[model samples]
Target: MDALSKSDPMLVVYTKMDGRLEEIGRTEVILNSLEPLWITKAMINYQFEIVQPLVFRIYDVDTKYHNTPLKTLNLAQQDFLGEAFCNLSEIVTKFNHSLTLNLRNGSGHALQGTVTVHAEETASSRMAVDMQFHCLNLDNKDTFSKSDPFLRVSRLSESAVAIPICKTEVIKNNLNPVWRPITLTSQQYSSKDDPLLVECFDFDASGNHELIGSLQTTIAQLENLYNSKAGANFYSHKGQKKLKGQLFLDKFQEKVQHTFLDYISSGFELNFMVAVDFTASNGDPRVPQSLHYIDPSGRPNSYQQAILGVSEVLQFYDNDRRFPAWGFGAKIPRGSVSHCFNLNASTNDCEVVGVEGIMSAYSSTLYSVSLAGPTLFGPVISKAAEIASHSVQYGNNKYFVLLIITVCNIYPHVTSVQKFYPSIVVCRMELSPTSKKQKILL
Candidate 1:
């Protein structure tokens, strides 16, 4: 394809799902380079239980389609430069989290090239830096008024590509603006010594934004600016022209927050609590259309599936495996409508033995309790919060997970539910009958 110049190579990554190839991401075309090291990353959710096959194909992009966006470019028109195949787990499980695969032609014949795939866990680190920034003097890009300045911070990759990490709010008609403090995580900046592109742009109603100035600095340099009480001068896109603008760091604070994995590894337990919706909107339990209807074919209903899906994952984190289960918006036998009644029908105890105990309790409750109206989550949330607060008061290293399964649109007492115990993680699963889709909101 490139007769005069070296190949302008671009890499396309795809995941094989159910024998169909689904494009995940594409790398930018590296012009006039045979061995191009692409900086663009294709992120895929790695599942431990399943094998995720990945296909990497290279293409020689023609000069005519150089201006076209990589996403919109027709790959069929580009010259094929062979492909490589490997499972995502292969790269992740390696010593350095990298694997090299020899490229092969369409006929599975070996080619004269190899592609190296590297995997980095983005959420492994919880370290973050919060910094407050204020501009001193910015270049006036507007003709009628002062420039509406805003800052955009981008981390420069190994290939010098600007990957945006964070941005500040636009301060209208102001050359000197003090934006709110922004936090950048370790995953965003990669390292303190890595170069970061801080660009100040003049806000415009039109899509075309005028660049006031840009400067390349690192997190370390920003910290130094804060310590020395000095400002960094901004320069033009090409470093040839120096602008009369400067960026001052008001404050720089770096904090190391512990991740969920850290807590689990440190003997912290995640206790599970479940609250099921028994509102009339879910239909009758005897009817097949009901959300709580037990299937005779041994297939799980939406409610059962939701409970099993969440409980199974959390059960391993909990040492005791005793889950507090409750039912809301239903009238129990010989009682008025109870918002937060124990699923096991116990007056004193609400905790069940295990996931099986929860299922048995839920099934028995359906037969004994009658579905009532006006879905309320306040009582159930209050009960879950009470348990969580008790655990905290006892100095227990426990995190409560409250799973609420519902088929309704919204909770009436959502505000109260939101203001519940801070230590409790509320996961609301809403199952739609029309679409047969389940949406889990945290």
Candidate 2:
């Protein structure tokens, strides 16, 4: 009993936000062990330019007084078993890729054990793992009824223990239960060759679960079984009784996606363009009900907010910060509903300095142009596509972002975008009648 009475330890991670620590993620509890090695990994986004402060809190879960979801004590009221703080940059640079950080108590005294950090590149793409299982003849543990069965999959750690990654929902009153599919990340699933331990259990409401059986296999073996459609049958013993089961890998595929870092490292820059609607359906700009009305309280409407939110993040990539702002569905000062007319009202100077410049041009055009209808977006889209194509011809690493504030189908614009495939983004905003919120479609 003394060997089974040890504490269950767990780890919690936090990131600094606006001078305060906010919990971002945590590890699973390693139950009933003195020297537990958690196979669960913690992930954090790495930005080269910013100072990202991270905190790791360790605690011994008192199963007798489980309060937190991770079944651990509260950090503020109850002291963490120990805490450690470090900047993300220091982990990679100061530690030469890995370091052992000392954990300290609230009084700043060093704790017993050390937490190891082995920094690695964040995966460029996330891979989803799908798993399923079926029991052949599960052992019945319940006296009055059939046993409730469920499956739990855990990866075998380098530290000689299995750490659970995912679990299936319990199916009540069944001896041959086919459990539902479980999903996990590539990191959580670990490597295809790593030993994955699957265990079947007869679940109980009183917190004491009976183990029906267990099996040891790798993802590679499961995939082979799935492809052959003849899953392997295995057996285990519990006290003098024998248990049997079959496990299957439903589906497993990895999709790779390129991020901004991929393009940025290749000298790619984002070129921004804005197209605003001047249709009569917007109502009179002077009216408070109008979607285009500049609020009397100095708040921006949907269009202005969308443009700012996107452009602010993109401005860092654009070297010159020059944006071309245009208007459609309106009679410009030139007396034409020119879909590609410059909102700046200049024939030769279509480009604006920055996001503020785009706002100025849009506001100024409101006073000069008369709102007209029969909304069409193909022309502006085509014009932006033409500019993007020219940049491609010149071998410049330029990506186009087109912001369209209108309510109409632009099927031809979709075709135009597919023609060049020039890394284009179309952000559309429309106000919903039933809801006070504005809807955005990408």
Candidate 3:
């Protein structure tokens, strides 16, 4: 807990304003240049970036010119740039990946335009994205008193300011409550590239009929909804060329994920093998001070704890929903020495999978036997590799024992031949010499 507190992945976003404070007997409230939109969208991780260090609102519904509807709705927009990411990437990078904009023009009519990105020569301390904003700037900075500016900026609150992602839905009059899907409702319907068909029911001053337009959903519109309502609605497909949709595993944290799920098998089945190290130096368990001591409460010392942790997490990954846990080292804890003992063959590993098996083994071994050590780790690796090394007699999901070598010394003796086994690797955990308790992901 103490170790975690010191570095709990600092998850804070700080934004402060700095200027010539104030003169003589006066003070001015610092204003933000851009706006913050804390939007929670199930459809996308939507965000906006400014190039010229200008601040603007991040919009959900795209518009060409925003003047009326933009003024009414409460939007959360964040201001960065003057103090944020000024030197991280180039200004063009921000523009090249700009968010789509569907806003209304100063003429109170909707207009469409794109804010493209480009990069300029690096200056100052680092490189930045050079930008090209094509939208009408309106040259109305002095008119920015929040009273008449068509585009306005706001501040991001201290709270998460995270809006709950709205579920897929269909709205009306531009005021229709965003729709939420129910059972059997297909989200395959898209509003892309089509016009919204509104079933409007109203009468004009002369009793003439009128029908308002709204986006309708269907498979033909695979990615679009009612777009006919607003001719500019097609802008929803803005910068489609820029979007390469689909997820890739390359972006995932491999170590953490592999530690959790073993997708090594081509078919859907569970099977795994486990092996332990029995090198000399693991002091006798009968001794209370050893890392493998069976504490009064009956938990293995840290050496055993590592095995327990690995076993605990692996039980869930093993096919047949079971695993074979074995130990190596000196002779057996019993009469003759058996190189391997199926830790969970006699009893199931864990109900919830993984760690439970190791824990159960730890509990069962407490009253019996003791710990010994020789300190050699090569045999531990070879033992696990032996199953696949000599013959083709293992399961397809054949994961060899992860020889958790808890020795401060031994790496120097390791050679190339030992490094050839892909499935066999040593998780070296030195109980001493570490300046602080380390929790390396691997």
Candidate 4:
């Protein structure tokens, strides 16, 4: 019945698991056309040992019943178009790597059209590709000595149609043309194992282009050639003549981003430390203009605001919520000036209970100590390194975070901390663009 009329076609594939056919994947519906080219691909895991029995079923969608076949769209109440059954192993064993099987109706009579299958393996992980290609010594299709070269990239889909995805800019009167790069995702572009066709053409102003040559290659193969610093040669006329054109991969980058569970499963834990700058450059705490100013209205200054903002997020990771708050360039209650003294004023206790405790200690330090001149970052950095070194000696698995708030000349001491510490984030605040300078240690 579907053969008698122009029908919307859909293909459903199934595999025999335990005596009954198990549905695998279905193609998209091609509307109002008897001969449809479905761009959707059906990917199956190829198993060598087991006899993977496959069934390809065609359907004519029922227009009245919302375009579903009669049994499923209805070809005027007869939805089934036709079906062909075969083992996947039989197709793979063919010499040509392609097979054309006869589609039979319910009464066992062969249909007008046949089902052709092409088998190819594909990579597992998805990739973001950056591709650029160039052609060399292309055959002149026009009267000129040189050929205007351009490339058309197409992806092979389940419908057996090569769908065009990208086209390069045409270069006139050039046998060798280096086209611009094209970016592709794994969904639109084939994976490392799947082959993509790149066809080189001689551009014509009349809109009639001539095909110079074509190359079929996988993303992984291009990457291999790039890694090897070699060029992949292209062929023409179904691999009979070796064309002069070669594809060179400009850049290839692959990344595997891990989830939060990945870190948790690996037994990783986070540890936090807070450092504060107590230099005279921050201004006198007694003055309202100072960064450490405590307003009468209880409005938090920049220093207090920064501590509260960072500690609030970091406290969740620390088991004890204990933070080591240290200050630099401050003269203690005693005559001596110190950079690594505890904000709590306790000689023995360096760890504070929580952010509230850190705040209480910081406020108490302001009243007790006097802001000293010439800020120094070395002592506090060395203090953190000492603690980190001790933890490593004890074989403790911990990530140390040292937060420093200072208006000091940190250049002389940065190299010392960076050479020994695992991670140190330097936050330069309240500075104009003209004053900023960057120096890399390594």
Taking all chains together, the TM-score of candidate 2 against the true structure is 0.52
Per-residue CA lDDT of model 1 for 1-442, tens digit only, reads 5888899999999999999999999999999999999999998886643567899999999999999998999999999999999877556545566789999998999999999998875653678999999988898898898999899999998999999989999999998999999999988998889999999999888867899999999999999999999988999987779888899999899998765445544667778999999988888777788787888898888889888878866665567789999999998899999889999999999999888999999989988988996887878888888888898999998888899999865544444555666788788899876665898887
Could you tell me the C-alpha RMSD of candidate 3 in Å?
27.1
The best candidate in terms of TM-score: 1
- Residue ranges of candidate 3 with Cα displaced over 4 Å: 1-274, 277-280, 284-287, 297-300, 333-355, 362-367, 389-401, 408-419, 433-442
Candidate 4 at 238: error in angstroms?
A: 24
Model 1 pairs whose backbones collide: none
In candidate 2 the C-alpha lDDT for residue 304 amounts to 74
- Who wins the lDDT comparison? 1
Ranking by TM-score: 1, 2, 4, 3
Tell how far residue 280 is off in model 1, in angstroms: 3.7
Model 4 deviation from native, Cα RMSD in Å: 20.1
lDDT digits (tens) for residues 223-322 of candidate 4: 8877887776777767788877676766677644343323433544456677777777777678776777789999987777767766765564465688
lDDT at residue 105 of model 2 (Cα atoms) = 84
Give all candidates' CA lDDT scores. 0.87, 0.74, 0.33, 0.71
lDDT of 2 by residue, 142-214 (tens): 9999999888889989885889988989999998787776776677767778888888888999978888777
TM-score of every model?
0.64, 0.52, 0.34, 0.46
| Ranking 1 against 3 by TM-score, winner | 1
